[model samples]
Target: YSIFMCLLMSCISGIGRATALALARCGANVTAVTRTQTDLDSLVQECPSISPVCVDLADWDATDAALQNIGTIDLLVNNAARTSLQPFLEVTQDQFDQTFSVNVKSVLHVSQIVARGMKARGSGGSIVNVSSQASQCALRDHAVYCASKGAVDTLTKVMALELGPFQIRVNAVNPTVVMTEMGHLAWSDPEKSKKMTSRIPLGRFAEVEDVVNTILFLLSDKSNMINGITLPVDGGFLAC
Candidate 1:
């Protein structure tokens, strides 16, 4: 059984690395997709068990071809995304275009490609799209990012409904201020981190493990009855 882990940018580090290790520990062969060959090499070194595929998700044709060669993914985790923080007034069209293309279109394209193989396999497979609390909530300087993720949240339900006949489950895991390397950069300052954490009932930033655990549950048979849902692993941030 093979699992395709679609990670962008720095896959060798951060939440991607942690998730790769988690899958490897389960004896599932992981196929990691990223933009840089150097980073792919590092991923191979870090998780010797993983198969690295260097590709730019922004390039639709390349992404499709890459998945075609891999063939029959039992599990697909679409976690590749980029966030741009700019005030509404200052945001450029290029920024909005790139954010939506990467965050929304990429996920749609990969899911469609992989779902075909899963349907042919008969028994079916599962997909977990990485969403964000920003999808449903308003945040400063995140107009484009929030809009893109909001589309993802809606798409998750649509895919679940359409793919349910094939027994292929589709779901999303939404996190709030997760402490990934990239996330740390966004809220690195102690004061900024504190202000964000204070809003969460849990009083802490979301850990990678928290989101990963939720995705693992959805991927596992335990969530068999669960579909078309965006479960927030956001430390009750959404509730508040």
Candidate 2:
């Protein structure tokens, strides 16, 4: 584990930040990538073991350039995503493009770059794409976001198929609403929260640690046989 090298995207906050910190604690040499310098600085200050790389993942050219500099990575977490909530008819082209750029295109680019390195090294690697349950279950006002995540899910399957031969494993984690700061705000209304929770068999929203732990399991040798699947950390929301 101490020898594990992990490159995590969107480590500025939320599930990304939690994953980065947990990885560092597990003795992985973590490279935390995010867009803001201040947040990167804060992450490093909080966990000095993490090496921060600041780059806007939405910018394809810049993201590719930045990732090129980071040498061989054993594990990669494509956790950067943009969600634009709008009705199908109200969704603008910019919103659709932006959502796909961050959620789908960026993941494809980063995974391609990292998987190449893994193949070259001949050691193989694990890649986890942070997708949403919305990809499978539709929600109102989430047309564009859901489409982008659906693309991500499809891309993950294709990547897994192609890379499995190289001993590379690719998977996506689709979680129900996790109680992050933003999650709390978005689902703050008690009635809304209750309605949502009633659907989940677990009777509550996912915690950041719940998702982080699943991610760690996927990255570990324990899940070596698992590949080409999207594991839902949704408290069985999809089951119902």
Best by lDDT: 1
Question: For model 1, where is the 10-residue window of minimal lDDT?
Answer: 9-18
* Backbone clash pairs in model 2 (N, Cα, C under 3 Å; residues 3+ apart or in different chains), count: 0
In terms of TM-score, how similar is model 1 to the real structure? Answer: 0.96
Full-model lDDT for every candidate: 0.88, 0.85
Cα lDDT of model 2 by residue, 1-240, tens digit: 322222334445589889888998888888877787887888899999888787887788898788787876899888888776788889999988888888888888888888898899889889988898999998999998888888989999999999999999999899999988889889999998999999999899999999999888898888999998999999999999
Model 1 alpha-carbon drift over 4 Å, by segment: none
RMSD of each: 1.2, 1.9
RMSD of 2: 1.9
